[model samples]
Target: MRFDTRLVHAGHELAEGTGDVVPPLHLASTYAHGVQDPPAYFYARGENPTREALERALAALEDVRFATVFASGQAAGATALATLAGAGRVIVSDDVYGGTYALLTSSRLDVRPVDLADPAAVADAFADPWAAEALVWVETPTNPMLKVADLAEVCRRAHARGCLVLVDNTLAGPALQQPLRWGADVTLCSTTKSVAGHLDVLGGALVHDRADLHDLFTTHRTTTGSVPSPFDSFLVHRGLKTLSLRTARQVETAGKLASALRESPHVAEVRYPGLPGHPGHEVAARQMSGFGSVVAFRYRADVAGLLRRSRYFADAVSLGGVRSLAQCPATTTHRPIPPDVRLRLGITDDLVRLSVGIEDPEDLLEDLLQALSPS
Candidate 1:
């Protein structure tokens, strides 16, 4: 079956008692395991029916055999990275989410920040003999930057060097891209984003192709107690049903916005994989079936004027929500990082990132036109 078709059907079993079409949420903290037939669910921390249903659906979406859920994307990412503890080194993308950068740098592993998008640069990062045991963390259509990484190349080189590769598929979402098929050992995503769609729930997911790695992540998740609640899991399960349609609408709007923004004289630069001039356009086209909603562009003039004049977008931080959002990454999302680090990353004060929504394309375009009139 096609992806959209499978999305609606996969991992969904009829509710046992009432024969409900959707899987019923099981909220029990602990389940009874009979002597005659032991139930698969035992405890909330170890496992839960609601969370398992979401995990199974996620696993199927990413074409993987196993998946685990977490309270937040950070928890999922941290737990997945923790699996590389005691390894000689870990390589991370320089422009990844600020939270991810903090988690890796402060950890026991020698985290090395590099441009994982550049296969050669990543290969050079592991030049040292100890790096043979390294782990690589990547993000394509990276946070705020909208840069696409060559996950396939990174996975190929890492696997050849006997290193594990974990690709954060948050920005593109599994609806657009699947890193595992590109040879990545594992895939990470913030289900809170496009997966949950409504912005009402927060959740994270880790998908692994290898059994041993899946077991390792499950153990870490259980030990650290970083799993998501049953209710949140249930919400995300419902969200998955509309992910395809929501993402498609948002992606279309984003493409139009990126094009319109480029025509404005106030805009200095536009960063979007869908843009022809973008460095990663070809790579993104090769790996992803669709370009995501988020768009980043540089506005040399005062952003406060732009923000105030805007009538539609909420001046907010989070992305992949049903409503449009706009934010200055330097002040909001990447504020934790030093000014110099952000500058080097091209996250300037004048830069604005837009998370386009499922709203009408004309409405969003008019909002941008009026708000950006001064630009």
Candidate 2:
């Protein structure tokens, strides 16, 4: 089956005897075991039927062999570093998510920030002696800034030096982009965002094609007890069915919003890969199926007032939900980074990040325009 068809049927097996179409939500923490032969699932921490279904669906969507689901995106990230990074340095994109920034900086890993959007900078970073046996972390169409990286180039450079590459695929879920196809060794995602579609579920996943990496991540998840609940797994799995549809509408709306923002006199700058003016537009066009649903722009007027006046867009943090969300990255998502450092990265106080939802495009656009217009 194709990608969209697989989304509906990948992990679904009709309930035995009942012939129910939807997969059953298995909630049992422990399964019955015999003396001679142990059960496939003895405990929930190591295994759960519902969670396994979600993992299978995730792996199928990424066109990979394995996937390990986590309680949160941070847990998945921490496990990826712990199991794969070894004792070598970890090179990350400079415009990474605040949680990711804090995770590497606070840990013992030798974390170095590199401008991953620039191929020359990536080449230079990999040339460094410290980069040998390192892990290169990438977040394309990166958090808040919407900067897309050249995945194939970075993967080529990193693999040339025997280094592994992990891509945070939260901003552009599998429906829009599959990093493994572009040579990413592992794809990390916040299932709490796009994968779940609705805002209710909180989970994460790391999808890859290697059995060795899968075994390592699964072991870490089991040992650390960082597994998602059966219900969260069910929610995310259900969300998978509509991913292609939701992403398409959201991407269409996002392009409209980006174009509108650029024309707004109250807006200073607009950042969206769909825009030809964006630095990473070409690479994004080549790698991703769609430009994604997030549109970020620098508001020339009061950011707080804009947030307060918007009727449809919620003043919130997370993205890829059914409802539109607006946030000031300098204060919300990227607050962990120092002001000076954030300024250097173009994350100004006036920057407003919008996660375009499945709402009517005209309504969303009018709300944004009125909010940005003189109060």
Candidate 3:
């Protein structure tokens, strides 16, 4: 089946007894079980029918054998890192999500930050003797910076050195990019954004082919109880049914806005992967099917003021919604990152990130124009 067909039909296997077309939210925390009989589901923490259906759907969508949904994107990320901590030091991209950064820095693992776009630097990082046991973390079209990593190249280099590669696919959802196909061992995302895209739900997920790693994360989730609610899982599943339609519309609007921003004298740089001048445009072209809906640009004027002045876009954090939003990474999404580190990663005070929505392109474009005008 095509992707759309899969989205709407993959995990929806309903028996005649429960003739409801939509799956019910299995909110029962515990299921009836007897010691003499084997139980497929004895506890919600271990498994819930609603979460299972969503996981199955996501796994099919991401082209992976397994998936584990979490309470939040950070919880999924932290679980992946924590599971691998005993293996060796973890290396992450410089523009990694601030929450992911906080998770690693607070841990005992020697979390190293480097430029994943620099193949030579990545090779060198994994070449160290310690690299034999290392784990490589990548976030292409990274957070607010919008930098793209050569996921295929990074995976090749890491796997050659016996390191595992995990790609954060939140910015470019499965509708646009699938990292596991590029040799990444695992792909994770905040389903809260693109998957449950209406901005109505909060959930995270990890999808991969490896059985061992699947058991590891599943055990951790079951033990720690960081699983998402059944209702949230149902919402994520529903949102995915229309993901491709929403993403395509958002990406089209983003390209138009990015071109306009690039032409502005007040703009220092526009970091849309669809834009030719963006450092990651070519790499994104190579690894992704679409350039995603988010665009980041550095402007010469007061970015905070620009965000506040925007009429169409809500000045807020978080992306992947039907309504457009603008935020200054320094004070919003990436604020948890140390100022110096943020600067080193090119997240400047003048930088603004936009999450394009399915709104009319002209309105979004005009809103940006007015905000950046010399009025």
Candidate 4:
């Protein structure tokens, strides 16, 4: 079946007890076990019916063998990285996404920062002396900057070196891009964003094509005890039903906003894959079905003053929600990383990451213009 059709009817069926159209939420923490041996579910930590149903649906959506839901995106990321790295191993990653960066640096795992957009640099990093037991973690159309990485090339190189490849599919979400199809061993996503749509729940998931990796992630889920609650899982499933529709509208709005920002005198630069002249436009066009909902732009004048004057764009954290949000990465998201390091990664002080919502295009444009203009 097509993606949109699958989204609405993939994992849900009529309830056995009431014949309800929606899947019933099993909130009980523990399930009854038989005398000899229990069925698939024994306890909430291990599995629950509601969570399992959502997991199966997500796996089907991503075309993966298994899917494990987590309490948050960071938990899923940590679990996947820990499973791949084991212990006392190096991880090569692009200097993006503050939460992921914190996890990599805080843990005992050794991390090597590299320019993911350049395949040659990634290859060199993998061949370096510190790469003895290394894994490659990539985030395409990377956070804040919207820099696109060549996933297929990187996966080929990493696999050739007997290394695991983990791609964070949060920014593009599974509706637009699937990393496993590009040869990635595992795909990670923060359902709190586009997948949840409503911004009402915080959740994460890991999908993989390999059975061994799937089993390993499942083991990690059980040991780490970071599985999502039954209600959160249900909400994620409900949000998934409208994923394609919401994303399609968001894409259209983001494209218009990016184009308008580029033409405005108060904007220094607009970074969006959907834009014709964006550096990674070709790569994104090849890999993703849609250009996604996020757009980043730099201010030509007083950034602080403009933000203060802005009425519609809320200066807030997190993206991929139904509400539009504007954030200053240098101060909010990427503050933990050094200033020089952020600059090296092409994340500037004036950069404003805009998460376009399903709002009217004209209203959003007017708000932006008023904010950019001097009061």
Candidate 5:
């Protein structure tokens, strides 16, 4: 079946007993055992019919053997890293996505941040003597900056050293790019963002082609009790039905916004892989079916003043929702990192990351123009 059809019908087997068209929510914490041995579900932490259905659907969508859902994106990321890396093992990652940086750096785990734009730097980071058992975690069209990484090459180099490669596909959802197909062992995402699309629920997921890794992550999830509620799982599945349509609208709006920002006087640099002059444009075009919905740009003047003047774009946190969001990363998201590190990664105080919504493109453009205009 095609992607859109799969999105709606993949894991949903209509109720055999009740003939319910929509999947029913299994709310019980524990399931009754009919016989001496027990049913598939014993406890909520271990399993639920609704959550399992969603997991199976996501695994099918990503073309992976297995998938596991988590309470949040960070939980999925941390679990994947923790399950893969042991004591003193190193992690090489891009200094993008504030939540990821916080998880890697603040945790007891050893990590080395690298400039993802430079493939040589990444290769060198892996070659360092301290990285003997390293795992490479990449976020392509990386958060805030939208920098692209050559996934196939990175995976090849990392695998040569026996290091696992995991890609955070939150920015470019499974609809746009599939990291496992490009050679990543694991692909993780904050389903709350693009997959859920409504911003009403919080969920995370990990999809893996390797059965061993999938089993390990699934074990970790059950033991750790980081699984999402059945209601959340049902909501995400409902949201998945329209993922393609919403993403198409988001991509269109983002392109319009990127062009508008580039031509504006207050804007100094527009960082979007879709833009022709963007450093990673060609690489993004090669890997992704469509450039994602997020765009980041820096201003020539007072960023706070500009954000304050906006009516349409909310100065908010989180991305990939149906409503537009604008945020200053230097203060809101990337503030945990040192100023110098953020500067090196091109996350400046004047920068604004915009999560373009499914709203009318002309309305978005008008709101942005007013926001960027001098207050």
Candidate 6:
């Protein structure tokens, strides 16, 4: 099945009793099971019918064999590292989500940041003794900065060094790109953002093709208790039905907004893979079906004023909601990073990150134009 068709129908198998079109939310904490007959699901923490359904759909969308849902994006990310990478050295993209940076740096693991977009830098990282049996953490079209990593090249280098690669597929989601298709061992996504669509639910997912890795993640999740609630799983699964449609609208709005922002004198630079001048434009074009919905740019005018003047966009953290959102990453998402490091990554105070929603293109464009205009 195609992406959208799989989204709507993959997990919607009719129950023998009710024959409901949607997957029923199984809220049972524990199932009735006897020693003589073992059930597939015995407890909510270990297994949930609703979560299983959602995982099936998620796996189908990514064209992977297995998927595990989590309570939150951070939970999934932390679990991926703890279960797979452990105390071993981990090489991550220098420009990544603030939560990711915090989680890695605060952990006992030897976490090193490398420019994953640069093939030479990645090769050099793998050359080091520390890279032996190491894990590579990559974020393509990286958070806030919009830097795209060459996934295939990095994965090849990591595997050659007997290392594993985990690609954060949150920004692009399965609608735009699938990292496992590019040879990544695992793909992590914050289903809270794009997958859930609405701002209501918080969830995360890990998709991969390896059966052994799937077993490890499943065991870890059961032992550590990081599974999502049945209702959240249902919500995310429901959101999947409209994933392609919503993503298409968002990409259209974002592309228009990026082009318009680039023409404005108030903008210093625009960073969207769809933009011809963006460093990762060619790479993103090659890897992704769409450039995604988020747009990052350096604003020359009062960053505070532009945020305050916006009517359609809410100045907030997190992205990929049905509602448009905007924020200065230096102060919001990437604030956990040190001042110098943020500057080095080009996440300056004037850098405005906009998460375009499924709004009318003309309205979003006008809103940005008026917000960036002089008073």
Model 2 residue pairs with clashes? none
TM-score of each: 0.96, 0.98, 0.97, 0.95, 0.96, 0.98
Q: Model-by-model lDDT, in order?
A: 0.86, 0.92, 0.87, 0.85, 0.86, 0.91
Please give, for residues 267-319, the per-residue lDDT of candidate 2 as tens digits: 99999999999999999999999999999999888899999999999999999
Best by lDDT: 2
Off by over 4 Å in 2: 35-38
Error of 3 at 327 (Å): 0.4
Judge candidate 6 at residue 106 and give its lDDT. Answer: 88
Ranking by TM-score: 2, 6, 3, 1, 5, 4
Model 4 worst lDDT run, 10 consecutive residues: 86-95
lDDT tens string, model 4, 134-235?
A: 677888879988888888988887777777888998999989999988998888999999999887999999888778887888889889899999999999
As for model 6, its CA RMSD to the true structure in angstroms is 1.3
TM-score of 1: 0.96
RMSD of 1: 1.5
Write candidate 5's Cα lDDT for 1-375 as tens digits: 888888998778889899877678989898778852746767899889899888888988976668889999999998987788764465555657888888887778777777666778867876777766577788887888888888888888778778878899999998999899889988999999999999899999999877787788888998989999999999998898899999999998999899989999889999889999998898899999999999999999888888788887889988899999999999998888789888887888989999989988999899899878895
lDDT tens readout by residue for model 1, 246-324: 9999999999999999998889999989999999999999999888999999986899889888888999888898999
Measured on C-alpha atoms, candidate 3 has an lDDT of 0.87
Model 4, residue 238: C-alpha shift (Å): 0.7
**Which TM-score value belongs to model 6?**
0.98
- lDDT per residue, candidate 6, 138-255, as tens digits? 9998998899998889988899988888999999988999999899999999999998998899999999988998999999899999999999999999988898999999998899
In the order shown, the candidates' Cα RMSDs to the true structure are: 1.5, 1.2, 1.6, 1.8, 1.6, 1.3
